[model samples]
Target chain A: MDVLINLSLNGLATGMLIFLLAAGLTLIFGLMDVLNFAHGGLFAWGAYSGIWIYTATGSFLVGIIGAILTGMLLGILTERWIIKPVYGNHVQQILITLGLMLVLSEMLKVVWGPNQISASTPSYLSGSWEVGGVIIIKYRVFIIAVGLAVFLAVQYVLKKTKIGLVVRAGVMNKEMVQSLGINIQKVFMLVFMIGAGMAALGGMLLGPYSGVIHADMGMEFAILAFIVVVIGGMGSFSGSVMAAILVGLSGSFMAYYVPDLALAANMLLMAVVLIFRPQGLFGAKG
Target chain B: MTRILSNRMNILYLMIAAFLAVLPFVYDSRSLLILLSQVFIFAVLAMSYDILLGYTGIVSFGHAMFFGIGAYTVGVFMKRFEPETSYFLLAVVVTIVLTAVVSYIVGLLTLRLKSHFYAMLTLAFAGLFLVLAEKWRTVTYGNDGFTFRVPEFLRDRTDFYLICLASMVVVFILLKRFTNSPLGKVLQAIRENEQRTESLGYSVLQYKIIASVVSGVLAGIAGILYAVSLRFVNTSVFTMDITLDALLMTIIGGVGTLVGAIIGAGIIEFSHHWLTELAKVHWIFERWIIFFGIIYILVVMFFPMGIVGSLKKLKFSRKKKDSVPVKSETVSQGD
Candidate 1:
């Protein structure tokens, strides 16, 4: 029972990180019909920039903010330049974004030097607490809390705010939204920025959770995020969270029980999901 | 047959083949033979990719899986069995059968999804294969791949180079015929518009599976040549980089043009060879992948239609401006 609880907690934390990345990916895909393969680059940049700032400033909050800002700034540039030209063409988008993915990863090697950087948990969130023989890691709890908070906040905005309404409308029918005189292009840029920022936030938090970050980690995790988006339903935010947790928990448990099958676990899940529900779990029927 | 021989493009192809076939005898340079052999192997791989991406409009991210399957099958057979001609032949047969089955299953499973979904699923499946290769240490020897001896006949560098060239030419001609057939026309129609093709009574899924199977088998053949050339096989055969190389080749040459894939492969392979060579001169050249990535972006942005496609477009426009009565049949045939 103890081991199970610990595994679930670990899975949930990892799921949240994946959710941060997938949320942005799903939103960008939903609203703009643009698949940004380089979103992972923003995630990696966030981790690198955030960790650097955290080390320099000796403040975790400042580091987190710095990472988000860096992600948004890079997001804007990517949106304005790389993604803008290949907007309607899926083939061009895949090729260009993949190129960007490579450039971003290689650039990380260029700037930071080709080496993995070790990260430590912040002083305040370094330890664990044991209650009734169930120990909970502080950092894991912190990650889950942040994930839930972000989910709720984003949910509120989508449900209540004017910009959120426009974004949702754009997802359903961009032409219809444009016919209503909304500047869908600005919304696209805005959504791309927010999505990139969230991915970066996920990367920042992932630094301490894993205790190390590498340039190639972005590609690795980006694949996970893509799996989540597929299983969750491309445009469904809530579905992404559910799918993320499912992937995380399956991965966590598989690692413990069937060690040899650990890596293949999530892939198997995705295949099963795809076979039964091609539109994804929460996706609307085509 | 005589009509095909008389065509201008076919004559150009024959001349190139004749030149390449004789060069190995006239010029006794070992390095050039090796480089040209490598180019031939990759050209086959890229053209196989063209059958799917160019002819059928399917963007697969798991092509390396078939390539890896081929390499590993040959590698394992040669290593475990005797390094004899019979075993090598058996390995080739097994690779074709395995690749066909795997591609069929994969196509059936994932082709039902939308474009991006299909791409992501194929990628996920490829990752699964990579993990399997990594973990199945008993057979694969894990990530530290093993090297094995080849058949006695293949030991000669000149013989192997000729073999690679022959295989490439044969595959190219076969594919050209495949693409110009009535079925190939249907595949092209699907590429232009899937729903419209389905409405015209063609089963889109079946045609996609056929293309996938052909592409997979050809890629497997290329993998066999690649492994035989190096006399080694490893998990790197399954990496995403191999698939990306094929994608870049197909796009940079020309999407639907089989010949363009060959040109793309040559350019990319030469650039790769030269860039790494330049590392000896400049420290900056040590990180050649950055330049590769930049080239990819610039090509997509400026040369979206690729080298062959853009040049063709330029020529067509110039002819139009010249007030020449361009034949509509020729324009449609070119497309």
Candidate 2:
């Protein structure tokens, strides 16, 4: 029972991290119609910057904010200089963004050295809480809270705001949104920055949970996030969240019970999703 | 064929072929052998990538999976059997068979996924191969990678170079023929408009799977040759870096052109030397990443059609300008 509870907590914490990454990726794909292969670069940058801050000051909160800011800055640069020219062309977008992913990953090695950096939870949140023979880690609970909070906050913004309506409309039909006198380009940039910020925050939170951060780490996680995005729906925020959790729980459970098939399992889920619903579970029909 | 190749282009190709044929004689023997072999292998990989991305409009990120299957086929066979088995005959038969079966299964499963979804699934598949290879160290020999001895005939570097050269030329000609054939036309049609082709009664998914399988076989060839050239094979050959390297090579040379794949591979591989040379003169250009990044950006931004594509377009414009006087005379006659 305790083992089950522990796995559940671990799964939820990891799922939240994935959700954070996928949330931004889904939004960017949904709103901009751009497949940013370099999205993982933003995640890595967040991890490096946030960890650097945390290491220098011994404050996790500062590290978190610093990482988010780093993502925002990199996001702005990516959109303006790198992403802007390739906006309508998928091939070009992929080529450039893929290059950027390489550059961003290599840059981490340059800045922080190639070795993986260790990150630990603060002492207050390091231990576990037990009740009725079920034990849960406090930091894992904190991660779950942060994930839920980010999800709910985004949902609230999407549901109750004019910007959200424009975003949804844009996702539905960019031409229609343009016909309505809204600057769709600005909206794209905004969504891209926000998505980058979310990915950054996800990276920061993931740092402690995973116990280390490395540059190439983003590509591996980004692959999973991309899988979640596909399974959920490219532009569907809610779908990304649910799909991320599904992937997280499945991966967590499988790693323990079926270690050999664990990696293949997530891929199999994605393959199945692609076969059955190519537009994705929550994606609107093209 | 005469109409396809003008006299000048023919000479250019003959000249390049001659250079490749004699390259081993001039350069440091081992480096030339390895580099030339690498060029051949990568040329094959790049050409296969063109079949999907340039012609079919399906971008795949898991191309290495097929390449790994090819290497693993050779590795598994070499371990279980003898190296003296009919060298070229056996490797070709086994690689094509093994790659075909594996690609068929993967193609059937993944061919239905659209756009980025399909591409990402392929990436996932590659990662799966990587993890399996890493953890199952006993059979795969794990991360250390396995090496098998080449037959005595292949051990002779000059003879081996000839074999690689012959394989490349044959494959190159076949790819060119395939691209201009009716099937190639159908692939182009699918790329331009899949639904329109579907409405015209074409089986889109079947064609995609077939093309994917064929390309997979070609990549498998490259991987097998690569394993032989290095005197060993490892999962590193199937790394994401190799997949991206092939993509970059294809994009840089000419996505749809067979000649362009070879040219692209040559340029990218040779740049290691070029950049190394440049480093002696300037500190600013010391980093290979910066050079690659800048060139990649330039290519995607300004010459997205690629080096060969741009040159083709230039030739087209020049022809138009040359015929202006004739066009004017014809217009006057009509008037």
Candidate 3:
């Protein structure tokens, strides 16, 4: 029973990190109809930048803020320069973003050097707590809490705030929102920035959890995030969270019980979901 | 099919072929022949990719899987069985049949999904194969790929070059014929509008599956030739990099044009060769990938229709201007 609880907690933490990355991706895909292959690059950049700041300043909070800021700056540049010209052309978007993904990944090697950097959990977030026979890691709990807080905050903003409402309205019907006189393009840029920040936050958090950060880590995790997006339904925020948890739990259990099949398990889950519900679990029907 | 190449184009092709046939005698540079042979192999691979992306409007991210299947079949078979000429034939046959079957299954599962969904699933599946290759170390020898000796005849560079060139030509002609068939017309209709094609009573999925099998089989053949050229096969054959290379070649050459694949492959291969040579000269050139990425971005931005497509458009415009009154009809149809 304690093992089950421990595994569930681990799975939950992993799911939350994926949710953070996928949340932004799903929204960006939904609102803009652009597949940003370079989104993973931003995640990797966040990891490197945030870790650099953390090691330099010795403050995790400052490091997190730095990563988010870096993501926003990069996000603005990507939207205006890379993504702007390729809008409405899926093939061009795929090709250009793929090229950008390569650039962002390779540029990391140039900037930070081609080696994996080790990261440590901050003093405040280090250690574990024992409850009866079960031990809960503090960092895992912290991650889960942060994920929940972000989710609630995003939900509140999206449901109750004007900007969030406009973004949602645009996702539902871009032309209708434009007819209502909202600057859809500006909103897209803003949402993109926000999404990048979230992905960076996920990256920053994952650095400490994984104990090492590498440039290529972004692509690997981005694949998982894409799967989560597809499983949860493209453009659905809550769906991303639910599907992420499912992926996380399955991955956790499969790794422990059947290590050989662990990676294939996720793809299998996705295939089953795709076969049964092509639009995804929470996706809107076209 | 007749519309694909004009009499002038045929003459141009014949001249190029004649040049290629005699160039080895003129140059006799072993290194250059090897480089050109690599380009020819990739040209075949890129053309196969075009059959799906350019002609059928299906953008797959798992093409390297089929390529890998072809390579690994030869790699593993040679390692286990006797490395005889007959085994080579058997391996090539197996690659085609295996790739056709695998592609059919993959297409059945994935072709029904929307664009991005299909792309993601294909990537996921390919990644699965990569993992399998990595983990099944006994057969694949894990990351350190096993190298095997080819037949005595193939060890000669000239023989290898001629074989690669012959394979490229044969594959090109066959694919051209296939793409010009009535089935190819239906695939194009589906690309233009899937719903309209379906409404026209064509089985969209069936046509897509057929396209996938042809592309996969061709990609497998390319992979086999590539492996034979190298006399080695590794997990790298299944990498996303190879698939991206094929995609870039198809796009750079001209998506729907068969000859464009050859041009695109030559440009990419030659650039890579020169860029690496240039890298030795300057520190800035060391990061050739950045320049490559910039090139891709620029091409997508300025020349999305690609070199061949743009040239064809230019030719059409000139023809329209030459023929009075026909200009008005063509101008309105431009979009």
Candidate 4:
């Protein structure tokens, strides 16, 4: 029972991490119809920057801001330089973004040695809370709480704000949104920045949760994020959140029960969904 | 004049092949041999990728699935070999058959999906195999993979290269045949106009399945060579990088052109060999990948058609000074 609880917490923590990374991915793809393979690179940078700040200043809150800012900056750069020109052409977008992914990955190594760095939980988060003979790690709870908070905050913004309406309208039809006399470029910039911010936030939390931060983690996690985007329907923020949790819960459970099938299970689910409904769970029809 | 030119092109091909055949003499023999074998294997993989990407206008990111199938099939065969089985022949037939079957099954499941969904799903399949290779460690040897100690009949470079060369040549001829055949025409037809082909009472799914099966078999052959050449088979060969490499080679050499695969493979393998040597510093390989990515982006954006493809276009345009410009016809201008 204790191990189960531990694993469950672990799974939720991981799921939250995935949701953070994937939320931006889902939104970017949903609105832009652009497949940004380089999104992971931003996530990695976020972790690196956040952790670097955390270690230097010994302030977790500052690290989070640092990570989010780093991601937003990178997002602006990529959106302005790489993604802007190749907006419509997928092949070009794929090529440029893939190139960006490589650049970001390489840049990480240049700044930080190629070796993996072990990141620690904040001093306050290092301990555990024991209740009813079960010890729950405080950090995991912190991650879960932060993840839910972000989710709720994003939902609040998306549902209530004028910017959210514009984002939705753009996803429906970029031209139509433009025709409405709103500066679509401004919206793109805003969305791109926000997406980058989310990815960074994901990276910051994932750093301590995994206990090891590496340049390559972004690519691996990006693959999962992409899978979530595909499963949840690209652009459907809610869809990505739900799918990320599903993937997270299932992966955790499977790892415990049938370790051999754990990795394949998510992929199997994707295959089944893709084969049966190419639009994804909540994907809009083409 | 046309016949004479054709003869010259043929001779040029023969000379290039002869030069490649003897390249090991000048370079480090062991490294050159390994590179040569890799070039051939990737050439086959690239060719198979071209069948889906260049010819069919479908960019499949998960082609490594078939390549992995080929590798895993041979590994399975050797692992559970019968006492009397001929390791060489048995491995070849089994890998091809099994890979073809797997491709056929995959085709049935995925052929209906549009480009993006199918592409993502195929990528998922590639990841699936990698996960399986590591997860199902018992049969697959998981991350460690398995080793196939060659039977006494074939051990040296000369013998192995001969098998590789013969297989490649045969597959080449087979692909040539496929491109000229009625089925190939139908596949191209589907690529050009799916509705038109459907209206003509043809089944796009059937054609795609057959092509995938054929491509899978060829990839399987290459996989066997890959294993036998390295004297190793691991899950790493099934990773996204391998798929990316194959895709890179296919795109670089010029998609859809029959001979482009070999050129792409040879150049890339040579580049990799040299780069690996140069990338002694830890961050060098990552930089090299970034450089390649830059080149990839440029090539895809400006020269959308690949090296050989653009050259072919140049030649065709030159042949007829005005020949009704072909670019406007093929390159879609707008949605």
Candidate 5:
């Protein structure tokens, strides 16, 4: 029971990190019909920039803010310059974004040097607590809490705010939203920025969680995020969280029980999901 | 069919192949021979990709899986068995069969999905293959990989170079013929409009599977040649870099044009060679991928249609200005 609880906690934490990345990816895909492969680059930049700031300022909160800002700034630039030209063409988008992904990764090496950097948990968030022989890591708990808080906050905005409604409506039909006199381009930029920020936030938190961040980690996690997006339904927000948890827990349990099958497990899950529900779990029927 | 055979382009292709076939005999430059051989190998790979991406409008991120299968099959066979011509032939047969089966299965499973979904799923499947290769240590030798001896004739650099060159030419001709057939036209129709093709009584899924299998088998052959060139196999064959290299080659050369793929492969391989050479002169050049990435983005933005494709468009437009407007449509259709 203890081991099970611990595994679930670990899985939930990992799921939350993935959720951050997937949330942005889904939103960007939904509203703009643009699949930004360079989203992973934003995530990696977040880790590198956030960790650097955190180390300098001696504050994790500041690090998180720095990472988000960096992500948003990079997001704006990517959307404005790189993605704007290849907006309608899926082939061009994939090729261009993939090119950007490579550029971003290589630029990281240029800026931060071609070596993995180790990160430590903040002083306040370090260590664990035990109750009734069940030990819970504080950082894991903190991650879950942050994930839930972000999910709820976004949900509220999407449901209650005027901009949120516009965003939701935009997802349904961009042309219709545009016909209603809304500036859909601005909304796209906003969503892209927000999405990039969230991905960076995920990367920032992932630094301490994994204890090491590398240039290639973006691609690795980006693949996981893509799997989650595919399984969750491309445009469904709530579906992403659910799918992420499923992927994380399956990955955690499989790693423990079937060591050899651990890596294959999530891929298998994605294949199964694709075979059965091609539109994804919560996606509207085409 | 005879028109295609007697086309000026065909003569050009023949002349170029003839020139290349004889050049190595006189050149005696081992580096140039090796470099050209690598270009031929990648050209084959890129052309296979072109069949799917340009002709069929499919963008797959998992092409390296087939490439890796071909490479590993040869590597393992050469490692275990006597390095004889018969065993090498056996490995080649096995690679073709395995790649066809795998590509068919993968196409069946994922072709029904939308473009993005299909791309992501293929990538996941490739990742599965990579993991399998990594974990299956005894057979694969894990990430460290293994080197093996080749057949006696292949031991000579010149013989291997000629083999690679011949294979490239054969694959190119076969693919050119295949793309011009009625079946190839159906595949192109599917690429242009899947729904319309389906409404026209074609089984869209079946056509896609055929393309996938052909592309996969050819990619596998490229992999075999690649592994033979190095006489070694590693997990790197399955990496996303290999797939991206093929993608870049196809896009930079020309998407739907077989000739473009060859040109793209040559340009990319040569640039890679030149960039690495420059790395010795300048420390900054050590990180040449930054330049590669920049070039990729610039190509997509500026030359969206690629070198041959852009040139074709330019010529067509100029001819449009010179000739009657009605003739422009016919000329464009010829492309």
Candidate 6:
């Protein structure tokens, strides 16, 4: 029972991090029909910038904000310069974003040096709580809280605000949204920025959780995020959370029980999902 | 006009073949021969990719899986058996069969998906194979891939170079015939409009699977040659880098044009070689990938259709201004 609880908690934390990344990717894909392979680059940049800020300022909150701002800046540049050109052509988007992913990771090397950087949990979030013979790590709980908060905030904004309505409508039909007199391009840029910020936030949080961060972490996690997005169904927000948890729990459990199959477990999950329900758990027939 | 174009293409092929025939003796530099062989191997790989991406419009991100399958088969087989011509032949046969089977299954599972989903799923699947190669130490030797001996004939660099060049030329000619075939024309039609082809009662999935199998088999052959070229094989063969290299070559050279694959492969391999050499001169040049990325960006921005593709477009457009072209009529005749 204790082991199960610990695993579930660990899985939940990991899933939440993935959800943060996938949420942005799915929404961006939905709204713009652009597969931003460089989304992982944003995540890596976020982690590096956030961790760097935290170390410099000695304030974790400042670090987080710094990461978000860095992500938005990068996102704005990527959207304006890189992504803007290949809007509807997926092959071009994939190729260009892939190139950008390489550039981002290489730039991280150029900026941060090639060595992996070790990160520490902030003093406020360093301890663990023991309850009923089970120990729950504070950082994991913190990640879960942040993830839920972000999700709720996004949901509320998407549901209650006019801009959110416009964004949602854009996802449904870009032409219809444009016909409704909204500057769909502006919405696209905004959505891309928000999505990139979320990915960076995920990367920043992931740094301390993993206890060490590397430039290439973004690509590996981006693959996981893509898996979550696929499993949850593309363009579905709440579905991302659900699928991420599923992947995270499966990964955690598989790692403990069947180490040999652990790495393949998530891929197997994705393959099974693709074969049985290509539409995804929460996706419409798009 | 079409006859003139064909004659020009044929002369170009003859000239290239003549150049390759004399390259080994004229250069006499072992390094240059090795580099040319590598280019030939990759050109074959890129051509296989073009059959799918350019001809059928299936953008696969897991092509390296098939290539790795071919390479690993040879590596494992040669390591287990004596290095003999028969053993090499056996390895090639096994690699072909395995790549064809695997690609057929993958294509069946994935070809149904729309663009982005298909690409992502293919990547995920390839990642699974990479992990398996890393974990299955008993067979794959883990990340430190094992080296094995080849036949005596293959041990000679000139012999290997000639063989590789011959294989590339043969594959290119065969693929050219394939893309010009009636079925190939249908595949091109499917690329242009899948829904209309489906309405026309062509089984899009079947045609895609056929293309996948052919491409997979060819990639596997390239993998065998690649493995033999180095006399070494490792999990790196399965990396996304390999697939991306093929993709970049296909896109940069010319998507649908068969000759573009070779030119693209040459340009990329030569640039990589030259860049590495330049890295010794300047520390800043060590980061060659940034330059590579910049090239991709510029290509996408400016040469959206690729080098050969854009040139062809320019010529075609000019001809259109001169006279109404019957290219569409000829294409319809092929169908």
Q: RMSD per prediction, one decimal?
A: 2.3, 3.9, 2.4, 3.4, 2.2, 3.3
What share of the reference contacts survives in each candidate? 0.67, 0.49, 0.56, 0.46, 0.67, 0.63
The TM-score obtained for chain B by all candidates, in the order given, is 0.95, 0.88, 0.94, 0.88, 0.95, 0.93
DockQ (model 3, Cα): 0.65
Query: Could you report the DockQ of all the candidates, in the order they appear?
Result: 0.74, 0.55, 0.65, 0.47, 0.74, 0.68
Interface RMSD per candidate (angstroms): 1.2, 2.4, 1.4, 2.4, 1.2, 1.4
What is the per-residue lDDT of model 5 for residues B1-335, given as tens digits with 9 covering 90 to 100?
A: 67766888888887898899999888899999999999999999999999999899888999999999999999999999999999999999999999999999889988877777667767777888998999999999999999999999899998999999999999998998899999999999988888999999999999999999999999999999999999999999999899989988998898898889999999989988998899899867778878878988998887776889888988878887677756555333321
lDDT accuracy of residue A214 in candidate 2: 83
Q: Model 1 misses residue A146 by how many Å?
A: 1.5
lDDT (tens digit, per residue) of candidate 2 on B111-154: 76556656777788788888887778877888888888766677
> Candidate 3 lDDT, tens digit per residue, A1-286?
8878878888999999899889999999899888787888999999999999999999999999999999999999999999998788776787788788888988988888778999999999999999896888999999999999999999999999999999899889999999988899999999899999989999999999999999889888888888899899989988999999998888888888887787789888788887888778998853
TM-score of chain A of 4: 0.97
B176, model 4: CA deviation in Å? Answer: 2.7
lDDT of 5 at B225: 97
Model 6 residue B238 CA deviation (Å) reads: 1.0
Lowest summed lDDT across 10 adjacent residues in model 6 chain A is found at A86-95
Q: Tell me the TM-score of each prediction against the true structure.
A: 0.96, 0.92, 0.94, 0.90, 0.96, 0.95
The docking category that best describes candidate 3 is: medium
Cα error, residue A164 of model 1, in Å, equals 1.4
Candidate 2: C-alpha lDDT: 0.82
Model 3 / residue A34 / CA error / Å: 2.1
Model 1 lDDT per residue over A1-286, tens place: 8999999999999999999999999999999887778988999999999998999999999999999999999999999989898778787787789889889988988888889999889989999999899998999999999999999999998989999999888889999999999999999999999999999999999999999999988978888999999889888888899999988888889888997897688887778878998878877743
lDDT of model 4 at position A83? 87
lDDT of 5 by residue, A1-286 (tens): 9999999999999999999999999999999888788989999999999999999999999999999999999999999999998788887788799889989998998898899999999988999999789999999999999999999999999999999999999999999999999999999999999999999999999999999999989988889999999889988888899999988888888888998897688887877877888778877743
Residue pairs in candidate 1 whose N, alpha carbon or C atoms collide under 3 angstroms:
none
Q: Each model's number of backbone clashes?
A: 0, 0, 0, 1, 0, 0
The sequence of per-residue lDDT tens digits that candidate 4 reaches over residues A1-286 is 9988888888888888888888887778777877777888999999999999999999999999999999999999999988887777655576567667877887888788789999999899998999999999999999999999999998888889988888888888889989879998888888888888988999999988889999989988887887788788778888888888888888899999988787688887877777777777977854
